[model samples]
Target chain A: MSPPLADLSAPPAIRPSLAARLAARSGALTGSTAGLALGHAQANLAVLPAVYAADFLRFCQANPKPCPLLGVSEVGAWTIPSLGDDLDLRSDIPGYRIWRDGELVAEVDDASAFWRDDLVAFAIGCSYSFEEGLIAEDIPIRHIEEDVRVPMYRTSIDCTPAGVFSGRMVVSMRPLRPPHAIRAVQISSRYPAVHGAPVHLGLPHLIGIADLARPDYGDPVTVKDDEIPVFWACGVTPQSVIASARPSFAITHKPGTMLVTDRRNSDYAVI
Target chain B: MSPPLADLSAPPAIRPSLAARLAARSGALTGSTAGLALGHAQANLAVLPAVYAADFLRFCQANPKPCPLLGVSEVGAWTIPSLGDDLDLRSDIPGYRIWRDGELVAEVDDASAFWRDDLVAFAIGCSYSFEEGLIAEDIPIRHIEEDVRVPMYRTSIDCTPAGVFSGRMVVSMRPLRPPHAIRAVQISSRYPAVHGAPVHLGLPHLIGIADLARPDYGDPVTVKDDEIPVFWACGVTPQSVIASARPSFAITHKPGTMLVTDRRNSDYAVI
Candidate 1:
């Protein structure tokens, strides 16, 4: 949905910060933004009409361990000053997924045509924030090091649903040795702005995740001999809920292509 | 080994403070002192002669993850002023295990006869400290509830050997759901003096343990379907190391048996 930013991505120049990244995203830069805006926070975008905004907010509050909320916008608002000044929710994310009546309509580079007065934008925390912390600690996150999207699974753990949002929880997996996993838990626990610490670790079957080699979303990475699969709540939970709610109109970030914001992960560390 | 504390395994007829507990332990009142002096520190006891004491102390220093040293008494001295006022190491513990050439020779209610001029007593932090914290937070420890010893295992993870003391790391197993396990990690991390956070969680096979149904030490507790096994470095590591060293003379607390002190668990809480 971003026009100006989308055009900037076509050039062979590097993108820096939200301003430059948004400039790239708005110009049809429908690509992954995993490491594009290094220092800024990357968010999972969810835009719904004002009619379901209150219910969705409550849903997030009720299921905080899985759906940690970062920021919300006013009705019909495309710009959320809290996240980033001049950042357009409709065009900031690299790619937008348009959902109509709870089904994927079409994936667009920008949401300019779908912008509605009643639509409210929401930014939820994602694993990408804490993943950066892990990397800085020299703790190897197998998925990131292997150049793959972290494997996301649909767990049997259900979210506390609101009026128009209800579904099973989604989790992202990162395989690490036990000690490394313990450190990851300790580090991630500090950032409640992110999905927080993992909802489950090991015992995939206990959480309704049947297969390690096959994931419901994203790419699967190798689980080394000394590693254990550590699972954290995924921002994709809200998307699954929206799909189940089947709203007549909705918008969200394309998986792995998030809305990079001015917020730093350390800003939310509790300890 | 603690005959004074072991004799009265039932709920204390009269609850005692740190001073009273020390008096009873020294007075040959052998009984199970699990909750005898609430809000005070209890320790793992390891008594060795000058020859093996150096090596054992080195073992603990090398593997601080398991054998966290609270205080070590001077050789031939049975009293340690730091852990407790007038704390006599020779007879303060209600029971003591007397070992000869690495073999448990006798289970004595007191160590009056076994106390050697070159013997050195060490006080290591015990899980009882963190377990008390968890219990205060309303977390249920099944073994304590079932009136059985905590199940422990000798894992394939080896300790960094020191002198003649070295062996596989021993871990205590506690079963908890993911959420409780996460909270436990946070709580335990505050008390690094007491082995700190768990060394491993879930995927027991990775640590060389194959069956949860059978334990190498202590009694097995129920493992719920939704629960994942949480493992922590145990105080038993010293006992295992001493077994490997096969010292001519060594004394330690029997499994589940401990030496109560005047130090409060809160005194050691880092945060």
Candidate 2:
């Protein structure tokens, strides 16, 4: 027998992200990129001077869970062709946070004017890929359902030190019932590049997070009494580490906003 | 260059369970078999009349997490050749519990006297296999450390019913810090024939477990303040099911005691 009509009528499973990338470059999509490019992988951006680039690379290597490096551009390059053929690091992301001496100086739609010959862009994997996996498994995501940014906190767990890039790890939280929490662990482990499995779950205080309601970054979603607060190593770790390291100059994507990439999310599923 | 002398001096990593199985068969090891066979796989036994064997097999198929059938013997047969070359179902286990009309009537070192010509024996995977995997990965098991039986409880989660076989799932609990809990999930997932990953974690009451201090089957293990109570589907589910179903006659391994098999735990590691 032939396949069903719906299967024949359906488009390819993975959608391309070139249009979204172009929209960001044109300053027409200057907001949170969450759910913007379905089936495409999103990335956390980090641009630093060549002097600190090698140290940051070591940092990511030593602490892969929180800083999973996807692609890195050569010194002074504005594009990482491996991530996307038309990917322009300076303006392909809808939002950018320019840092001076580890302090956020400005948030802008374009970083082209601030781009310099010494800048090196590092693309780190984001949790959106695994979140998509969880959603596909019918696991409900609290932040997505509530229409709010995921709750993130500063954890007491220290990252393995590498040069000046050292700080406590930051984690994003999701509240799920026990069964779904177990399912999340299995599903997320398949995508090792995207923070992998949770770093902590159940007891928050053990990880040094005092209050689930008062997050260090992003907005808090309701955590039901019966639910477990599962925490994953957040991509925001690099930003926090940069803030602590006090680099003379650095650039990162604003929280909740990410660089949309041309790669399919399925490519990141290791298993 | 030749390998180190120590490598040549060391014996094979996986030790055979033949001696341990022989001891049980001879009635020399008439007690708990928790650590009797170090590198071998142990199984929970369930013997039923041939009339109920088909329904029991369907029940196991419908609820694999709780009743992972490792092997089954022919009606009136006493050996499962696949599990062991000379495995005698009637006397290979360290201890046996005989049930009559859903009530335990006797606990004996060997079931040879009670063995019937119309019975079938089932070998269900036990957690001891994955516990070895967890220990190999340096994940501490609380029950082993405390020298107590791993706690088993009756949960609100119901198993898929088949004919006269039906009951709520029974789970084994282990207290672990959040990080270790996550690691245990990943490690156990590789051995799906042995209960696979956890069914629930953290909140006990959510699974109808009101208190951690009291368990329905095995002795309770200490749960640290910083640790999360992780629960996995226990092989004891079949025992509970047989009891609730009020079968005319049934046989099972006593709590904390099991049937020593020739199969290495590594043989069950699917990944």
Candidate 3:
């Protein structure tokens, strides 16, 4: 019964604690964070030069639902106190994508060699925060159940721009039946620190998504006839903005992979 | 450019305080309580003889989202202290529909003539609690905007039957674009004392709703091409149960007319 996509996904193995997961990333484990570090917060990383940090912070704050800011590392310092101890942003993510002049220049396992004193790192919350809550509620996340990346799409809904950062919002997609989607929206709303609730659903065309089969980013999952695509503002949005608003140099976690942190997702839930 | 319906509705006059609303109802100034006693709790009334009261209470407890029990009057007593000190089951609601053998026999302005010591009253929370929340958030409710009764439908989703009480769930619908629907889910989830979250959305067929244009109950709201019908469990569900349960003697508030209490809607919000 093995499908042709068998090589496309890895197993849901026993994950390390937040600290161990970060340490693994620090070493040479270049991969996604889908099923790793089960109970802790995993964030989308975007490190920009000090010059554009203020504008980017405003962009994140203005679009809180899509770009929920979880932690911001001190300028020139690689550590964020609230995230973890001994957490060096430069080398803790599974991989880093370095962008220069609005193009990806290279993908690397460690960013310590690229660290600059004037660089500031921003950790925005991801849907993984509420995925834990969803799983705890016994709702099956389709992509997670099938062992694939959550589909991501670029939408017509525009994000309020700040400084050099401005672009359409990017969203992650999940497929669920009517009742489950209703429950998902209710459960996800409690974690506003994550991408809370959905931005678009059912009628994807209204949001300018031309094809669900071909996502703008991430691997596509099967959509059942009875199910509708539910979209959440994605963490990839900041990365997309970094690509579009290319500074002289910028660093972000490779898509799918994230910065696993010491903080628990429950700490950020509003209900 | 005002329509005939608008002119008729415009003279609802000054919105009354809770005290004024209660006094009007008690004095047989019978009318729909919608938009009256703003910010106060308006409830769905269900009165049954004491012999079947405990089993009916179990039915409500089993289905809290649809039949949120606000308060229950003591056997033969007219007042429910938790809902209001002056609350009278027989006359506190502007209008009442008397049922015999599950068939509506007649409507009455005041039930004081029919009041008996054996009758017990149950006050159930209403979706009006969350409507205030939605309005506060600037999300437009279609029926409220159109000044029509909120559209309700009898769905195939069944409520757990207790004793002689059993029937399909009744859902009140409001049409909104996908994003607003998501926000409604979050806002309504805060008021579990009302019908919390939603029973269904997007695909009405999944819930046995074959047509949206002709609802079994309430006026049809205009669903724009870009809008989707979002459904919430309605307090009318108990009324639907009465229809199927075929109780020999039962009384309910006439649709649109409700019992207004001193308790603020905010008092029932969980978060």
Candidate 4:
């Protein structure tokens, strides 16, 4: 019916991220979703029992830079129509990390079997959206060039506590030349739904990152001598909070494996 | 027809910048313009003969970051109506530096004696506009806090050559913490007419500045250990170029004493 896909060699950006979403829906995309949807906004998935949804929502509202909410599903609902027409929350993400009592218990491609009637899913904005914004302006993204996950660090900056949700803020790093770093701030500031501009830059130890190579989450990428590390409040921050809050049952997209959304990245751009 | 002025003890920002402009016109204010008119856009004056105006205009166009043009008067004209209703080129600035063949020959309170029929006055955008924007956002300005001139440096970064105008870029430094640095970029980027965003930050040595303590122009303020220096392309670049190109006769505002225009800083903001 679809003419068997006309151009397989076209760049991922040229093809809609819907292709990645469809592949994920079929259990074919079982790994990272970093470059798969270059143009569309991707989302970090967070699922928790309905009992914890209100406080988690309050946490997101309190710490907007780290937990910018893209959408939240009704209890037990798998689809958020505003994000996509065909998005199935339980099976759409490439991978999911199941947590119990603050410990990661399982990693799975399909989350359908673990779904409960009281489950509530939140689609948090991802840095991948702003990464696309940076790349559009010809600012180099080091982690993307190195073909690795963006380096994320747990910082000494604490998130504002909301009921039971609280933890240190997590940040994603991108090393850019000074001019590009300034330009990146301008470009990323337009997409506040994602992490927004950078939270910290230049001084790493001041934010409690002792060594550049040792990242708390995601792989370490090359930070050239000529470049200064610019940091954005990361989506992984919610995951860190979940671990700290020790919710009885929770789930999240595996680091770097995001929910490829139908929404264009520009949808979240304020101006 | 106007009522008597009230609240002299109130902050200078409470009064319109026109107050400062009128003071300069009346010979009542003849020192640095800093902190005099806080919310207005001030300008750097560059008066040159018609023979060199075209090349200098090209230089401003070529290197907009360093020499953002606010208004260029008609050849031999002293008034830029767009910048102010009653701005006079000769006596409206606190001090003027008279240059002869690239040498500083005289410092005068008024340049009416030096006005020539072939002279063209160029009003370049000053960082004071963006500084007001930064201060409005509650970001502290270090130089203003210490009551000293902002530190300026000549960078190794070369300007795009335009005929007889060619020289290194000059930049002004403002030290801020990491979060404020990112915010400053966003705030300043909106005021493209006034140096736009910072050209460099973090590593000063990379831009050829050997010591932060010794600036090429202005006084250095204390850069706290927690703060990193953010650099903006400065209005001083045009004066530096005048020295390098050695235009036979030129007139410019003394470093800190700018042409305080009636125009509000918001007039220069893009969005």
What TM-score would each prediction reach against the true structure?
A: 0.88, 0.95, 0.91, 0.94
Model 4: lDDT to the true structure: 0.91
Which model scores highest in TM-score? 2
- CAPRI band of model 4? medium
* Clashes within 3 Å, all models in order: 39, 0, 0, 0
Q: Rank candidates by DockQ, best first.
A: 2, 4, 3, 1
Candidate 4, residue A17: Cα displacement in angstroms equals 3.4
Ranking by lDDT: 2, 4, 3, 1
Model 2 segments beyond 4 Å from truth? A1-15, B1-15
A1-271 per-residue lDDT for model 2 (tens digits): 9765666676765335877778889989988888877889999999999999989999999999999999999899998988997788898888999999999999999999999999999999999999999999899999999999999999999999999999999999999999899999999999999899999999899889999999999999999888999999999999999999999999999888898998888999987
For each candidate, report what fraction of the true interface contacts it reproduces: 0.56, 1.00, 0.83, 0.78
TM-score of 2: 0.95
Error of 2 at A271 (Å): 0.8
Question: All candidates' lDDT scores?
Answer: 0.84, 0.92, 0.86, 0.91
Model 1 Cα interface RMS deviation (Å):
1.6
**In candidate 3, which residue ranges exceed 4 Å CA deviation?**
A1-15, A18-28, B1-28
lDDT of 1 at A79: 80
What is candidate 2's CA lDDT for residue B48?
97
Best by lDDT: 2
